[model samples]
Target: MTSSDTYQGLAVTTPVSLMFGRFSDAATPLLYARTLKELLAQSGLQKDDVDGLAVSSFSLDPDPAIALSRSLGLSLRWFQDVNLGGASGGIALNRAARAVAAGDADIVACIAADNNLETGFQDLVRDFSVASRDGVYPYGAGGPTSVFALLTKQYMQETGATREDFAALCAGQRENAKTVPHAVFNEPLSPEEYLASRMIAEPLCLYDCVMPVSGAEAFLVMSEERAQALGLSYARVLSSIEAHNTHGDEASPLSGGWATGRDRLFANAGLGPDDIDIIQTYDDYPAVSILQLEELGFLPSGKGASQLATSTHWQQKHNTSGGQLSCGQAGAAGGYLGLVEAIRQLTGQAGAWQRANVRHALVSGYGMVVYDRCLATCATILAAQESL
Candidate 1:
């Protein structure tokens, strides 16, 4: 019930200024699409090669299809605007796969963009408070950090976890980020250093949080039949699920909604956790992501923190790309940054951070309900080839 038709080839493209970390004195800024046409034109596809446009993002002022339409001078047969929080990106990829199979459109594009952190640091932190739902905003400021703080506190109380234990997660993920070229935070971390880091919330330190970064990534999606015709090497979209925990007060009881979402999606795909080689977890904070993994069945519900700090998990390639904490966050597009990394790992192109012989990738998008702290979540498993 959760699986769908597969896609042929998937390719990633980004705007020029966003590609290199050398311009602006190697500074990264929010990507502007003025140069996207050139990069896209160089994609080797004919001008009319694309017929479908699917964009999942939070920060692109003008949606991508409309922008790409004027820039590339093409009309589209299908257009999708996915506004879900974290899970929005992967959900779009799943929809594109189904559309390709249904003959809705070929050469569909799944796009997620990131922007520079320098220009918007203050704006972002302040806006975090405004992100609360109307109902919860009155009682207390229910932003990402506050809600996760409450959740992290509960996880700690239940699991006998300590801030030092959580620090293990910060230290480990930072090490993972150091191996990733595009990672903004390439610095190595230590548990002691993690303990010393300034606390933004009660338990989460500065390094425990995901930074705001400017950039964008894209995937060219098509049917397997179309892929054979084009001769491209890419992955297929296997399964996807999106569930809204619109009521976070209720989410407190489950406390494992994200993992439940992943289980549901993979069940639909007819596979279990063992089939996945890598995963990109939605992480605004390191602990939330770590907890999400356990809920995802990689570890027991309350065992996320323990596994997060283990050297074996890294060697096993579970959360390989350092997660959003080390990379950078761009609202909804943050998940795609993780997806792009997963795609790279699967395609043997992850460069320095490539996991050894990766194949299946399960990506989880955990989003703030826009109503409460992580009110909804979505997960998708992508494969290099047909598995069944």
Candidate 2:
């Protein structure tokens, strides 16, 4: 077996920032610039040090990653435009790690940002998928809420999950949001409130869906030695996996591609589900979060809703940053939320809501819900440098 140590040598270190909530003046490029500026400032690195870049954005149309490099005055040796929606962050991390390990770049900045102006979200939803525009939207299917509501209903029927189960998860995340400085929804949420909230789609109350806002998230990937030399604390990527168009035959997806490579992911990390100390899932919807937990082995298949309702484990440290549901999904930046939050928790930088003695974090992403199911899925296992 190839030694996991070789892969673990690559690390994601300091200079992580998440800007949440609405930004009317800012466009996508401005949001990207803001995150890049903070990343450079925090890492104490000059723009010249960023030899590689990876960008993810929904509204950065007519401009690709290469275009942003020039706009930002960055002459890069490597660049990538990740458009995988929520999975983009994981893929970016995986790519950046490989780039640094292969000597393609010494330092890489992975960023996802976007501005959600008036009508911006409606436009995105209208053109999100061919199936949506051609088939679903015409019938007023109500975009992702409708799509996910169908999935949630199926999941509940199969697993005997009640609306309260979903409400509990949303309420718990809202409680966690209370400590995050940038979270958009800081109000205490009770299960009663969640249950009483207006229903956007059947079985999916207003609180069950994520609020779209404008923001950005960013992080740096480089050699562990480079991070240490910079006096930065870092998180090591124990293992990562990505898959596309998984389980395509299913009418609606109850599981994601994370399960396809989950065994390999754990094997490469030399760890298992029980070893994880924290979890961050791409929570565009509460039901999606539950599905990711099941696919990633944190909860048993078909048991996520029941476990979430009954278990105290999820209430404590999962989605410690309140997730996008509370922080507001900032277009493509939603993909990086969990990854950035996991890095924070693992590096002991998650102030206020930081869990004690966090050594391992499991982060997962699911995106590109075009037709009947999400086409992209990815997961990562991050460990504290000391644990490595």
Candidate 3:
């Protein structure tokens, strides 16, 4: 692979989140429309002002980006349909930044929304990809829980991580969720309670899985000068990187593409892990979070559990928004959750759980598990405008 590239004079602002409970009768288009409306209102822009759009969803079947644009009555100069699952947020932000930098569009909205119908999730996973439809689902390995179960098990065995390590991660996020009004599982989760939660798959318990809900998360991308003219709080994109299927032939993979791109990710940003004040990792599962931390150079590979257990580094610096574990994963919106929260914290919009003097934040995304391993991995670092 090549070295990473940096984003210049691009500002990410106007974060919006509309997360319904475990289920929402609202259609995917309606969710997107609502999110866009909020985004426009927050940015003080008209529908005509947004000249670009980027969207990600799993249930927008028979409806591509063009269809959504038509439905939303948007006349866009540019558009992107992102399908990177949990990695969509960073990818969308990266692509939208490039679009604005290249003068393709003046203002871009990056949004991800989805609905949780009774059977929608099942249908999504069963036919997610050729690997799942033809190879994995026919035998009864229907969803990601089982696949991640095996991954978590192998990670535990290899890294000497225990259920307690995962429990700490979940419980801490739950505590953080308490201050987040939109979090679905805000009740304080103790380690004892996490351990006692029923088992969904061997080594994967109930609390370890993300609750699928229907909702949308969105943010606006524009030039730094435009943001200043609008008098808006914003975060500057330092550097972003993405890699897919980096493991190649490793079927039961225990790692992700972050390892392949992390050095350049930090190097291009001119900041090391210690410089980051907060980190928002895609927490589809605790073990996956651990892997991301290790791969991102937060901790040594095999020492994840020990370092996490013994130190407050992760406890203080990680997932200040409670993550998908507590907030409920709204399909592709799970990808945008961390990004939105990072923008919030950086922009001084994060209410109670906001950290003081958060100069920089790191957000990572992992998603699209076809069968054994997640295929998409992406990360972006953002700095508060004042810090720049």
Candidate 4:
């Protein structure tokens, strides 16, 4: 089936729960359990009501999605284990929505979690991919930071982007972080401070890297009828698209696969970029987020840097949760951060940092950095319940 043809009438509604902050005692399964408990409490859903399960985690090794059902004592009729990293949330939602639409499951609980032990991150980066283990790590590439620094340098040279341009975006996100109680970086930040921060990798400073933390995020997917019956407010998925390995052959990649299906994505949603009230892009690095904006039709390709530098549009409506930059990247849960935040803003649950009239939101994910660039790309447009 085509990407747009997978789930025509399914909607993600109700009871989105997120648990942030660094957890020293939590394991992967425990995080999943806590999130599920909160989700059930928020939605008033009994354990038996969840017939489908979708999970994404970096530390759930040895145990998979099916294992979680047993550990959580859930009798699921459908299950999925999403390992797409940053793209896992979008992919899990797409799959769970399709299952609900197909009558294979009544309600699907999608979750992502991980524990950040002392050596967990290092171990993950080392084994992220064959290319990294055999090629990049041997030279002390310093994991994702090094890989993205090269891309940032090339992006700057190609677009004439100055350090100030990147710093401005970071500073704006920090400002947004001040309102998010769970954000790890809540202190006031200025472009001057961003420019002066210690550089981890050339062109990528400490602010540019996502801090590793242990946490989980979860949301539920069901039919619109079910959500209404439960008297729950939900976000409707107007359109979604996923692509992988689009530019695998391109050396030193500049764009992701979002460009491949952007036209169809907006067409399927019957909405354009201008209609979106807010945007959330996978922000392992600011450069990647800018690339997503360009490739997803918000800005002209290769022009994101200049537009971001001159425009204040993003400062007000983009990544309102301060994104992973301020919240800390919680393993696979990083992928779900934007999705959960979008749901909160749309459902009137984003108390302090909520947008005024968030009728529609654009959320994008890019992940699975192999050798040169991220191989997976996914995006979804969500509409408020009132709009539906």
lDDT of 4 by residue, 18-119 (tens): 544565456789888888898899888999999999998889887755788989999989999888889998888888988898889999999888888888
Which pairs clash in model 4?
none
Predicted candidate 3 versus true structure: per-residue lDDT over 1-388, tens digit per residue: 2222436788999989888778877889999899999998899988999999999998888777579998899999999988888899999999999899889999999999999998878878888889888877787653888888888999988878999988888888888889898899899999899899999987999999998899889999999999999988999998899999999687669879898989888988889998999999999888888888899998898778767766565776788879999899875849999999999999999999888899999999998988778889999999999986
Q: Write model 2 residue lDDT over 273-348, tens digit each, in one string.
A: 9999999999998889988888888888888887887766787868888888889887484898899998988888
What is the per-residue lDDT of model 1 for residues 71-103, given as tens digits with 9 covering 90 to 100? 556578877766565776777777776676667
How big is the positional error of residue 164 in model 3, measured in Å on the Cα after superposition?
0.8
lDDT against the true structure, each candidate:
0.62, 0.85, 0.88, 0.85
Superposed on all Cα atoms, model 4 deviates from the true structure by an RMSD in Å of 1.6
On lDDT, the stronger of 1 and 2 is 2
| lDDT for residue 44 in candidate 3, whole number 0-100 | 90
Off by over 4 Å in 1: 1-43, 61-68, 114-143, 246-256, 259-264, 331-333, 386-388
Q: Relative to the unseen true structure, what is the C-alpha lDDT of residue 176 in candidate 1, on a scale of 0 to 100?
A: 82
| Candidate 3 stretches greater than 4 Å from native | 1-6, 331-333
